[model samples]
Target: MKKDIHIPVVEDVYIAIVNEYNAIYKTQDWNAYIINNKAVDLELVLIVTSGYSKKKATSVFRKKLDKLPKQSYAKIELMQEELFALNNTFKVTFFEGNQMFDKTYLFRENTINLKALQSIPLMAVKGVLAK
Candidate 1:
């Protein structure tokens, strides 16, 4: 008899949005939030990405999240310099009950719209959870 091992997978979890904000120093800042819409809890989540570029991708942000509860989110701040570029993407990886999950999200995707980002108010606070 052959034994079949069940593997867990992550679903309904994604890089919900990338938001821009006005800083006190007359500059801008950005925040990338990851939302977990599933019922299971994700552990040791790592969010990494390279800034927008047609030539070569540069590491803009890399951080590990301890845990993300169900129907919750984790936020990662992006450097002001990184916000100016609009052609980048994010790679999200995490573990769900010993099963590893990974996915890549583009900045221009339906989740994050370039046009909408440009029109946001200076201090306006918007997040994927609101949408």
Candidate 2:
């Protein structure tokens, strides 16, 4: 039975942390975003995020979308500078037609920094991508 079971691979989807200027706060802030680079739309998208260290952990956050169009992106949450010290995780699950896909993206402690910024797909700004 195990050999007959099939788990679809999740591809062309990413969780990125972008450093953007907050117009209201008048300071630089880090924001989490979900990028869907696949050609087909994603349905019933669900994401859970959290940060943790050996001694402490942040609260788990949940977000959902009814549908995410292809080659588009959406903001997931705002990340505080303090969270950078912990291991951040984003767990994503979504359906494409009748198939369901799941993936977990992680940013190791202190990995989300200016020096790691790169040109993120499906977005105009430079950001750090979760692996």
- Which candidate ranks first by TM-score, i.e. highest? 2
Model 2 regions more than 4 Å off:
none
lDDT of 2 by residue, 62-115 (tens): 999999999999999999899999999999999999999999999999999999
Candidate 1 off by > 4 Å: 1-10, 18-29, 55-57, 79-84, 109-114, 117-131
What are the lDDT scores of the predictions, listed in order?
A: 0.62, 0.96
TM-score for all predictions? 0.64, 0.97
> Given candidate 1, what's the lDDT at residue 108?
43
Given candidate 1, what's the lDDT at residue 64? 91
